[model samples]
Target: MKNKLTRIICTTLAFGFLALPSAQAAESEFSLDRLVITALRAEMKDLDTPASVTVRTGEELKATGALTVADALQFIEGINMYSQGPYGQSAGRMSSEIVIRGAKKGTLVMVNGAPVNMNGLFQLDNILLENVEKVEVIRGAGSVMYGSEAFGGVINIITKKQVDNSISSSIGSFGRHSHSLNLQAGKLAFSGSLVEGGETGNVTSTSTKYTNYTGSEKISLNGAYRFTDKLVMNYTHSKDDINKEDISLSTNNRQQYSNDQESVDRFSFQYQDDTLLANVYGAFREIDYYTRNNDGSVPLPTMGGYPRKADVHTNLKTAKYGLDTNKQWEVRNNKYLAGITLETEKYEQNKVIMTKASAPASPVITNQQTGPFERNVIALYTQATHQIDDERKIILGVRGQKTEAEQGKEYTQLLPQLQYNEKIGESSSWFVNIGKAFRLPTLTEMYVTSDRFTGNPNLKPQSGWSYETGWKKQIATGAVKATYFVLDMNDYIETDSTAAKMYQNFDQYRNQGLEVSWEDKLSDKFSYTVGGVVSNPQAYYNRNWSRLYSRVQGTLGLHYTLDKVSANLSANYITDRANDAPPAFPVSLTVNYKAQPETTVFATVRNVLNRHDVTTESTPSSMSGYFYGAPRTIEIGVKHSF
Candidate 1:
């Protein structure tokens, strides 16, 4: 009761921010129509980019009261937050996955222009939304500039480059608590955050009965230094630990437990001048996993029967070093970019599994493996942009990539891109783009081994190509766009369920989609946005529809500001999406209110329609059986910036 009152008081205090005096530079108003897009690897206006792009500013995200980067992206068109957790809990035993335009395994997620999404880990929980400056989502092929894991699209998270000194604390339902601090001094800046939270299961349902307790903790630190006019450096470190306990099968007492922990460290140095740009970076990532399953059928020591306990432990480490350089030149009506990148990565893995034995305390190690491998890659790329006339422009780009592995065959690929943009009117444009991309198999997917799955050393790289055409119109108060895209892929990798869950290349995969969106200011105090994507994805060999690919997905958002108070409401809906047994129609809602200039309160109610449909893949033989869809949940929180 006391805690509830305290929360009310905090919320009340936050709402009081509106009562304070308003200060601004001439009370000038900013419009979303003025956003300029730079995530296409070039400086261009949103309507002139020749691709489908969505930009979410930090201010807009903050208004939604999302705690993590992934949460803030839920409303983006074509993005499927595959698993938002049961209830409002964001952390599960495994990382949350997202599917874009019917492409589940081909998305690339980056932070400050660095790749952080690794094999099988797609969540962005490590990066807090509080530190994010903006998010850019490119909904098409990006391999020409971003290399592997980019066949679907690219999600670029930009962190705050300038942070004012401040400290803040927040508490929410589901026992969520967090504290953060940011400090800046001249050329040096530092920021850090710690979050602790979890969920308690619902008691009324069969699925939620024993599948309740989930807990997680995350810590992150970032620092930057500007040593000189031409030299700058930045470093970031983060750690996450998650725990889950649930019942796999409802008929038995088989309780499942899992613990996953990860740590990442990265450092980058950059040099830039008029026509010369260079960067050197190093990164290290490590993960530890432990899982235990006990059916409780094993008799106690006094009963003289073996305990039915099964456990597995795995440790994986990866390190990467890379150097990149780019030179820009201009000649009359033509501009060119020439770049080269060389990178080397090392990977090591250790795994052990224990099964039931005569001794209850100590089980026999039934499976064990140790693997260490390395990969080297070099890429050369060049791009040219020519202005033919005031109404027409064209871009041509090409990249050659080569990869060599320590214990596998070498691979090479030549990717190319062509784009054209034409001005339709003073405030509208039409564009088209075609590109090729490829992704090499990761070390874990190529060398790791376990009871349920095995890696094939001879796995081949996956290659694909995509084409898109779009039109955009900017009105007096907002913008609208429509796009049509198609993807053709070959040598796509997948698990051959007929062969002990080994990985194999699927012959061909195809996807075609249409995306449309509109955002406008209805009035001086109100704004609205509506967008959606519809796609058809299929595998040629089997002639089957892709799993979990939604045929129709959409989002709606509304914002209103009156006097000192502001309110925001947004919802996302997905239809004809498959995960476990049946197709699900999932919808989520978020509402936020600002009480003060630096304080706000928000509530998120996911699965508002009470659709308990599963949102993840499930397997019976391993710890994956615990994967389930999020349930209807409501979370409320308050934040006060100081």
Candidate 2:
């Protein structure tokens, strides 16, 4: 493993791209002052924030032709993105999910600096980049400033707010078609997109077995009115709909289809000045889903007398509301931010099953239950930053949260953090950060009951501590960075297959990792970026597998530009380090040509190697299940700006 990793890193450096570590520079041609907010919940210089952060500009994302935020995040280091297939392909466990530092459930996802992770599942695949300005990622515990579900890190998708207007359309492989538009006029901004497509061949089995198809549409509107130079009112609303087929869990032999519909509305009134900034806001999220399983063939009495045919239907609905207030003050060389957040969520589910046996032994089950499974959370947090000297600073923060669930379970938690940063030389700086973080069980994990799995109301929240240190160097061309981090976790929540297939507080785990990355512009027309990470994990969960993540992973990219053309070649590698290892090594190439000032043509060939043989075992029971990767595919698109 070490030799292979060394070869990968050496090969990348041989191409004049040295692999360093995490944290991204905010400075881009289209950004303002190179400022980021995910690290501190306030705008701070990219390299100055006392955390390991990474930023991907909207332009960079657009260049990648990624249909979703989850797709775009795969290029960064220290993050393990597992997908059954390319971008929109795959279902169930193969669907896209991110793991940072071997921590999957501890990540916090947000949009416009507000928590948007729904139902405690960290699925960000639905967040398209049509109107996003940038994505900021803070890799490490962030609960001290962002509250719960930040045990591993924070990912904040910042939308475009400046005045701008553009439109584009594209058609690609597998009957894929999409259209998008972004418009901004004075205080009003609107962006929307429509996409429809599915796999041309079978998703998993051969001969087009899994009937795969997916379609999604979304619209967002934001309006901000300046009441005065010191005050403003902002309103934002968004609606998204997704319809697709669920390949179902590999363990399930049933074919299923599902649909998800969601809508969100937010309003905020704010007051800001040189010395003070405050805001009051209210938001709501409504999510609805429907699923049906079709098993057309039934068994006869001669064939073991199993159910000849069966049909299952499920419906789930959730409503979430949030009210929050935040205020910040600046006193001399000291800065302080204080905020309070209140949230309430309610969920309901219904299921029905009908089965037909060989003879007169037919059974039907209908379970209709309305839990209004409720959850209420109140949190208060404050952070202070003090400049110790000309080149040194310290940050201190703390947060307290009270949570109440419908099951009458109540709990309170406190998170604290400390960080120090210093300038070592004219072009180098270093930082050390330590923090405590936690994640409360989601409503689904606590109250939802299903035929295959049961919820445990007694499951406790997972809490942990993280320690991180890093050094960064700003060079004339680009930059280099390296980060080392460790996480000690307790009361981890995982499915227990030992008995009734239930959720439980399994055990504890420790993860230590190192990351190094570098990006450089060698010339006016050539640029390259490379990064790699190594994670060592120890699991004490009484499970056979000690680590569920790859021991070594890396990414490399080379880009070239001409007056009217641009091209990029990238590669990613993941070492099989888990007990039931699933390794991936995919390479891709992309090119864009500006046929005219207002028109551009693009082509992308992903998985150019066509290496889809990667496989892994099933979960929970750890049975003989199999998972694969996306096959090689090509896509061509054209866009026109208006």
Candidate 3:
């Protein structure tokens, strides 16, 4: 590993040297507009953000065939997907979740700047990435700006706005395909897309073989109309349905049926002029999950089986209304920003479970449940950027939020954040930030109950403090960024691991890490990027039980463009992880691909060596069930645009 890393460093430096003369000659053509601007609220240059941020553009997404957000995020550094399979499946221990800088998926996900997390269940599918124009990732705590559940990081998905009339389509492996269209005219714009796909294969579990079938379909619409110069209206709607048949975990020979349906609608009004800006928006989302499991003869005493059947269904609905107001003013020789926001969310979940077994036995169990939860949060925040001198600036901000949960139980928290940026020279700058963040227990974690899992109503909120410092250098030919960060969490909430597992609050953890990255346009036809991260995380529970956390990962990538053709190859490696235990089998990999512009001719391969490494581990009891990485599969496809 060391030798490979050394060779990579040398090759990168050599390329930079070879391209220096041309870079200097073309310096006059360089413009800030060519650089991507992330939606980090401050509108700072991507290289100047206090936290590590990565931007993946729509063009890149198309070239990579990234049908989901998880797929798109695979090339980024320090991000990993824990899923049952390549296609998103609810079972098999691999949840459709993303781990960022070693933090779990409960991290905040935002669309445009509004929270989209439903009832603390991050149900966002990568299908949304189809219409995504760009994604902005903040690699550390952002609760000061985004509210609770921003403990690890924030991923903001910015959807495409019509800039021109266009249509595109493609068909690929696993019976997958997609179509999209966009139209723009003056102040009126509209876009729509459809995605349909399916999978059929033989799946094996515990030495038992079963046929699996999975399919999904989605439709979306977005439009914007300008009523006047100061006010505009925008609307969006989306619906998705998925169904599958697969083998069960406990009964490896028995087959089960599962289905999911989700829908979302959003409307917003924006008024802006000069120094004042305001936005008011309303959003609604619903998700439904249904499952049917089969039990064969020879009823087990523990499970109460023999010709048994179980049906489980869950429904969730959320309504959110929020308003944001921001005003900019000058104080002394600096600019100051003041903002106030009010948001209210009403959430409800209904679960029904029924079971019947044995021709002669009556219904053994039946459950009809309703869980209602509501939260009202109001926040006032103020921030100021002071120019202390020609090369130094400081940002000070504070936010206070009052939250009311179910039964009018209220909680309030005061979070303060500070950042400093200093220009060391014409080509270098340094930045540092310190802030606090918190996460409230999810409704599922508080009140939901079933034969498999139980909830705790007395769960307490988790809070943490995070700090990071980094330096960025834009040299004559490339840019380099490196940061070190640490997080100390208290009152962490995790499932209890005793004999009869239940929800508990006797866990605390600490995560610390380093991230280093370099990107260079070695030449007009060739550009490359490389990044690496190392993290050390540990968890402590029951006062004396301590263990290393799972998901310490790393990544490297290279991108080259020649005329109308481009190629990108990325390699990701993750060390073995543990949950309150010791290290297990680590996941390591090298994925590579290339694409041609306008031809739809693409070739790619994953797990080139066919390494059967487990990418994740189960929590609580620390079971070692494994998820198989793709075994050297190759894909070829064509795409067209009009």
How do the predictions measure up, each by TM-score? 0.86, 0.83, 0.82
TM-score of decoy 3: 0.82
lDDT of candidate 3 over 65-133, digit per residue (tens): 355565556667766655555443333212456666666433787765667665564534433454567
Query: Model 3, 14: alpha-carbon shift in Å?
Result: 18
Regarding lDDT, does 1 or 2 come out ahead?
Answer: 1
The residue-by-residue lDDT of candidate 2 on 98-163, one tens digit each, is 677778666777766656665764345545566568888889998877777888888887766553
Among all windows of 10 consecutive residues in model 3, the one with the lowest summed lDDT is 24-33
lDDT of 1 by residue, 1-642 (tens): 655754664465346433334322211243544443333465577877878888887777665556677766767777877553542233432466766777657788876666666554554765666677788888888888777778888888777766767777766657767778888888887888987767645311244335655778889888878788777787888887777666654554546666778887877787877788787888777878777765577543222333432277777777877888888899999999988889887778777776655656456676555667888889898889999999899999888999898665698989999999999878999999999977788776687765567788898888889999999898888889999999888886766655477777778777898999998875666677889888876654333435535677788776666555455556676666543334555444455556777776666655555555555532222223334554455666665666
Q: Global lDDT of each model?
A: 0.70, 0.68, 0.63
How many clashes show up in model 2? 8
Clashes of 3: 4
Error of 2 at 126 (Å): 3.0
Q: Evaluated with TM-score, which candidate comes out highest?
A: 1
Angstrom error of the Cα, residue 305, model 1: value is: 15
Model 2 spans > 4 angstroms off: 1-33, 84-95, 200-310, 355-365, 543-545, 577-579, 613-629
TM-score of 2: 0.83
